[model samples]
Target: MTTHPAPTVHDVRHEETGEGQPTTGLDAFAVCALSGAYSAVAEARRFTAAILEGWGVCAPVVSDAVLVVSELTGNALRHAAPRGPDAAESRPDLVCAAWLALAHQEAGVLCAVSDSSRAVPALAAPDLMAEEGRGLWIIDRLSESWGWTRPDHTGKTVWAQLPVPRPTR
Candidate 1:
């Protein structure tokens, strides 16, 4: 068996400010295999939770935010596999990457997932009979608003905004 190089974090950017102030943001990125690995998902969730917590997010909202990351990561893993096993082994440089951005906007936290896949995500039709195909739909219902941005033909970033909880007097 061959060994795969561990993923590395790159291009991390962050910003923060007081509540009722201008938008602040935090972003983390990693490059890893498209295989269905628990470690990859766990790391992504942990990183996301950390960023949200650092930005003074509540526990419940942070949990939900992590779920969004999981969904997006799962989608990337399912769709963005390398050409073949040998191709992956011979050239690890083509590995798929996951980019998570948590931005504090006037309305809420904008969570964005960027991947090295060209395919765009869509909400599947409601199907009580089906067991799968509802990730985007669930994201839409949970988030205030969501969309995708394709800066180039090679990749796209899907983002969703979760409203901040109103403070109690």
Candidate 2:
């Protein structure tokens, strides 16, 4: 999977507050571009863990964020198409790409996955013994809140926020 370097994290003052405090939530974020391969799911999890840890996110929140990222990335890879006129065309030589973004909030971390499909993710009522169709349910149970957005017609992004305890610093 091809990945992009995260933007440097630095103290970002809130313009309205006029205080030199650090930026949180969407203002300070990290993103990874995932290739079409299934391995992208694992890569997204690893990326999430590293970024959250580096940002001093607590262990439990980091764990939840990683799982959420994995499920979202996996769903996108399995069900969504790349944005383009040729999106439906199968090209063995070319791999589709998805994007994963993680932002550190004051009390939680926000995770989002963007894919080229306009289809919204829905919860499926699978049988109790079914191995599939449980991603969204798991996300709902683990996240404080989760939802999706369509930024234009070319794609959709599913996002989740995982609560974290404030640090003692």
Candidate 3:
């Protein structure tokens, strides 16, 4: 008997936002695979850098945005694993299908991470000495406002808006 290797996710795509769309001023969008141990964080950095560069956002803000994406994507991978190994292999497909939207809101640049999982992220208290459980906490502190939205509950999108820095005099 032969066992087939599970499928992996790849080939991310990007699209520009349309005028008057529900998500306005969306400069760039991307979707990447969430498979393997580090795919999410890698993709988050890649997408964040691309979007930030395209928008001409400065280095510091871009760095912070990438960090936020890393945390959010990491949480998704850690918590939303598939049932079996084969199932896990197929998870990359789901992750690749996950969407990211970068929009300009009154508050600042909005980074939205959307996934097929309906699970909502919670901010849990972590031991000060602990090495984990601070992803959302960091996000909360850095973002002006962060929250999740589920239009029909089939999936949810978590978002954070970072204020645009003022030009240095």
Which candidate gets the maximum lDDT versus the true structure?
2
Model 2 ranges off by over 4 Å:
1-27, 82-96
lDDT for position 83 in model 1: 46
Which digits, one per residue and each the tens of the lDDT, describe model 1 over residues 55-115? 7778888888888777776666566544444746744655445556667655677677666
* Between candidates 2 and 3, the lDDT winner: 2
- TM for candidate 3 is 0.71
lDDT of 3 by residue, 1-169 (tens): 1111211122223444576335434454445545435665797789788878787887888888888888877776666545455864665446354556677544477777666676777777767898899988888888877877743334667778788787779
Query: Which candidate leads the pack in TM-score?
Result: 2
- Scanning candidate 3 in windows of ten residues, the lowest lDDT window is 1-10
Q: What is the lDDT of residue 120 in candidate 2?
A: 78
Instruction: Quote the RMSD, in angstroms, for model 3.
Output: 10.5
Candidate 1, residue 108: lDDT = 73
What would the TM-score be for candidate 1 when compared with the true structure?
0.68
TM-score of each: 0.68, 0.76, 0.71
The lDDT values for all models are 0.64, 0.76, 0.67
Off by over 4 Å in 3: 1-37, 88-97, 151-153
Model 1 accuracy (lDDT, Cα)? 0.64
